[model samples]
Target: MKHISIIVPEGQSNLGTVACIVGAYEIFTRANDYWKEKGKKQLLTVELAGVSKNTDFHEGLLTVKPHTHISAIGKTHLILIPSLAHDYQTAVEGNQLLLDWMVKQYKEGAEIASMCSGAFMLASAGLLDGKKCSTHWSAADTFRTLFPKVNLQPDKLITDEKGIYTNGGGYSFLNLVLYLVEKYYDRQTAIFCSKIFQIEIDRQSQSAFIIFTGQKQHGDEMVQQAQAYIESNLHEKISVEELSSRFAVGRRNFDRRFIKATGNTPVEYLQRVKMEAAKKAFETTRKTINEVMYEVGYSDVKAFREVFRKITGMSPLEYRGKYNKEAA
Candidate 1:
């Protein structure tokens, strides 16, 4: 039987973390039951292993007790890290012992997987260096700044490389669990679990759910001004050349500074700002596709649709239909 240790990290006893831990336990246990019902041997031994015996959350409203301590676990085939609290720095600092155990487990040939912001823990433990990772879109900027060596793909729903795996923001971890089920068991079992859990399987991108509020916390006054200009003048055709001149910076220097400050080129930032506005308009107003397109300063329908689809993983009409209940 394959041994799976789900690390119940200290100082991360929030509701989401608990849900993921319990959810994973249920899924794997149920998968084993399904296997056994078919006259097959039990395939997995899933346990909650942690550095601490118990962790409390919400001022003692909730407490999680692990099945075993990390030190007691000898060798496991997989280690699962649940979503951590949003105070990522504190979460990482407080769980140093757990992180060290995870690193040691990985070194001993254990595959690791992190859910949502749990990627922060994996990255801090040096398990994700120079590897492709996916986290919540809201945490992308912080993750990029903290782990510049890791390739961050916020748009992706899940990432798998070598023996490490990561999945995007909240609830999307269900999809990753289903993916793992398929890998550890078989396609039929994965499909069965997906149906039982009511989780959509094979979801490949979180792009459609991401609200691209451009990264503006880089402390660059000029970049902040540029972002403000883009947001305030979404109806205008703003050019990077014009922005550079208006900001009294050379075009090349402007592009370089913009990328450094915002993790996006000047043009990319403008498009994201415009697209974000268009998304809001689609959600709240009964604007026609062309009306929204023209309002965002895109005169060409083809260009607008292509860019919208590329950034959002959905066509303009599809996005509107999905978000605007009246449109449906």
Candidate 2:
């Protein structure tokens, strides 16, 4: 069985642990049917191996044994490092033993991945040199200041350079996991995992931070009113002219202002909101694609499928098949 090792940072923290447990659980559950179909002995196994937090013997969230199966550095197929506490002001004091182990593992061709602040640890390990990576926007400045060699793209949800993958923030970690599942298994498995986890698999292209940040800037009274209107009546026909009329602004002016504030056209923003709502129903409810289409304001099946594919890169039928297979 292929093993994915999630290396917890030196500090006695639970952030990475939380991400690994949830991500691994969803991955296995969704891939269960696929494994059975292929007659594989077992699906991928995830192991969380915590490293020492200095020599002071600081007890961590889980009880530490002197010897738990320390990963065969050269044998692990995938190694993941979730967000860690490292910044310009606070240097991440790492153990030499852990660094050497990681270097040996990388040399053996293990796919290394990081999430959120975890990029800092990977950067310090010399794995991110000359590589474009993403991290939590709040930590972007500090990471750049600390490691000038790593090209940081704070806007991306995640970046994959060769076998090394890094992503920004907590939610983006889910996007990274979905990407991995898609890479290792298939797009269908990733879709199944997203449904099992109640996540919007189609939202892989959208950055949660960017969406929320744009919403903060759109808190203007008129824009807020329009947003409220759209949220309350997502299924209703919402046109630029309708919003302009409701907000008492000229069509051109409202369109320009909304686009400027939200970084997407008014219709695009509305579609994003509607897509999120529809994705929730797709994951949680036993609705047919046509039913979901009409429920999400797309009366035409072709149009709905086209938009869903454009946003998520998967067809509605493929999505349903993945979930249905898992249910079996």
Whole-model Cα lDDT of every candidate shown, in order: 0.91, 0.67
Location of the lowest summed lDDT over 10 successive residues in candidate 2 = 52-61
The TM-score values for the models, in the order shown, are: 0.96, 0.56
Q: What's the CA error at residue 272 for candidate 1, in Å?
A: 1.2
Index of the highest-lDDT prediction: 1
Residue-level lDDT of model 2, residues 89-157, one tens digit each, is 242565445556767888888888887777887888889999999888767656766777888777677
Clashes of 1: 0
Residue 127 shift from truth in candidate 1, angstroms: 1.6
Instruction: For candidate 1, write residues 1-328 as lDDT tens digits.
Output: 8999988888844788988898899998888889898899998899999877788876788888999998888899999999988899999999998888888988989999999999999999888998999999999999989998898999999999999999999988889998999999999899999999999989999999998888877889998998898899999998999999999999999999999888889988888888988999999999899999999999999999988998899998999899999976
**Top candidate by TM-score:** 1
